[model samples]
Target: MQRTILIVEDEDILREIMKDYLLNAGYRVLEAADGKEALARFEEEEIQLIILDIMLPELDGWTVCRRIRKKSNVPIIMLTARVDEDDTILGFELGADDYVTKPYSPAILLARAKRLIESRYSTQENHPYEDTLLSRSVHVHIPSRTVTVCGEAISLTHTEFEILTYLMQNQGIIISREQLITKIWGYEFAGDDRTVNSHIRNLRHKLGKCATCIVTVVRAGYKFEEQI
Candidate 1:
C-alpha cells in the first residue's frame, strides 16, 4: 500500500510544492492550510506521517503536535522559520521526531521523510535477536519493537529503541557514534555528535536510573553492560 503523508503548512506555495514533490516520489499526499484543518484531516484519513509547520492558523504546531502525541505516535517532522536553538529543542520536547528549517532543500526534505517512514514502519521479523535469551525483567521483543523492564513497559522513540536494541545485541562491544549514526539514522551524521548524545540521554531517561544498561566510554563511544 502506498503511504499517505499529511502536510500542514500555511504557505500555499510551499504546500503545493511539497505535494507535487511527494506525489512524484510515489506517496499519496494530503494538504492542509492550517492546524485546525490538519487535525480534522488527520482524524478523517489514514496518514502514515506528517510534515507540520510551526506557524499556523487557529492552533500552532506545538499544540497540534502535543494533541497528536496524545492519540498517536505517527512520526512528525516540524517546519520552523526560527533559528533559535530553544525553538528546535522545544519542538523535540513537544513530540516532533525531527525538524526542517525554512528555505530547506526539497531533496533533503524528501530524503528525511522517506527515511522516517521507512524506519518507523519497517517490519522487524528479520531481526537477528529474535531468538536470543533475555531475562524476564528485561524483555526485547523485536516484532513489536518494544522493551519491558521489570514488567513495566518502557516507551522509547524510534531512534532510542533502535539504539538500545543494537547495543544490547552487541553487548560488551564499544560501538562508535559514526557507526551508530550510519546504522540507526541510515546516513552519515557529519559533525553531529549531539544527535547521538541526545538520543542516548532520552533513552537513559526513559529506562530510568535503575536500568544501568548503557555504559559510556570516555573519548570513545558506548557499550551495553551485560545484565548481571
Candidate 2:
C-alpha cells in the first residue's frame, strides 16, 4: 500500500500544493486546515508521516505536535514561516522528526518527507527475525532497530541509530568516512566527514563499556568488531 501522509496547513494553496506533490510521489495524501481536523484525521488514518504548519486555525501546531508525540512516534516535519532559530529548536524539542522554513519548495518538502519516513521504518526490513547481533555486553536487535547495553535500553536519534546499524552490519569492514557520510546522509549530504566522526563518537559514548566495539582508523574511516 502507498504510504499515507497528512498535510496540515491553514493556507489552502500551500496545502493543495503539498498534497499534489505527495500524490505525484505516489503517497496517499490527507489534508486538514487546522489542528482540530489534523488530529481527527490523524486518529482516523494510518498516516505514515505528517507535514504540519506552525500557525493554524482552532488549534496550534505545537500543541498538536505535543499531543501526537504523547501517543505515537510517527514522523512529523514542521513547517515554519519564521527564521528564528528558537522555533526550529522548539520543534525538535517537541519531538518533530524534521522541519522546514517557510517559502520552501514543495519538492524539497516531499524529499524530506520520504527520507524521514524511510529512515523511521525501513531499518526493520533489512534484518531477519532472529538476527540479533551480540558483542560482549551489547545486544542489537536489527529487525527492531533497538540497542541495549547491560540490559538497559539506550535512546538514539535516527541518524545515530542508522550509522551504528550500518557499521555493525558491515562488521570488520573498513568503511571510509566518505562512504559512511554517503550511506547515512545521501550524496547530497552537505556536511563534511567530521559529521560522521561526531555521530560515531556519540554512538561509542552511548555504547558505554561496549564502546570499544567500534574502532577508529587513522587514515581509514571506522570499523566494528568484538575484537576491537
Candidate 3:
C-alpha cells in the first residue's frame, strides 16, 4: 500500500523540498502551509504519517499535535529549527512520535518518516490476536493497540504504546532507558534518556490510578510490576 505523508511547513521552498523527497520515494504527499490547514488536510486524507513544522501559523504545531492526538494516534514527526531541550520535550508531551531539527538532510527526514510509518503497519500485520497484558487496573491489547485503565479507555501516542507494551510483556524486568530507546525508536533515534522519561511521565499521567504498575528504579530504568 502506498502510504500518504502530510508535510506541514509554511516555507514554500522547504515544503516543496520535503514533498519532492516523499514523492520520489513513492509516497502520496499532501501539503499544508499552516497548522489549521494541516489539521484540515489530516481530516480529509488517509494520512499514515505527518511531518509537522513547529513554527506554523494559525494554530501552530503544538496545538495541531495536541488536537490530533486527542482523536488519533497516527505517528507524528515534528520539524523544528530550535535545539532547545524544552521544545523537544514539549513536542513529546504533545504526542509527537519523532523530532527532526531544521537544516537537516531530507534523507534523514525521509528515513525517520519511513521508520515510523513502517513500524505502525508492521506492528498491526505481525500481531493478529487479541493479545493483551493486564496488571493492576491497566489492560493493554497488543493487536488492537488499545489501552484501558480501570475500565476507562486511555489515549496514548505511538511511542508511548510501544513502551508500555514492551514493559508489560517483560513484566518484572527492568528495561534500561538505552534499551528502550533502541527497542522502541531504533538505534538511529537521536534523542536520549530524557525522551524516554518524558514519554513515561506522560504514560503514567494517563494511566491515572493504575500508574503504580510502572515503577522507576533508582539509578536504573523502569519496570512494570503489579502493584498490591
Which consecutive 10 residues in model 3 have the weakest lDDT in total? 121-130
Candidate 3 deviant stretches above 4 angstroms: 123-130
lDDT of 1 by residue, 1-228 (tens): 799999999999999899999999999999999989999999999999999999999999999999997787788889989888677767766667677888888788888899888877776664455644365356677666677877787777666777887887887899998888887766622225665777787777877853577888998999888456
lDDT score, residue 115, model 3? 80
Residues 29-78 of candidate 2 have per-residue lDDT tens digits of 99999999999999999988989999999889999998997787677888
| Preferred candidate (lDDT higher): 1 or 2 | 1
Score every model by TM-score: 0.86, 0.69, 0.93
lDDT of 3 by residue, 104-195 (tens): 99998898888888777676557643478887688888767789998899888898998998898888999999999888888778898889
**What does each candidate score in C-alpha RMSD?**
2.5, 4.6, 1.8
lDDT values of the candidates?
A: 0.81, 0.79, 0.90
Structure candidate 1, residue pairs in collision: none
How far out, in Å, is residue 212 in model 3? 0.9
lDDT agreement of model 1 with the native: 0.81
The better candidate by TM-score, 1 or 2, is: 1
Angstrom error at residue 60, model 2: 2.1
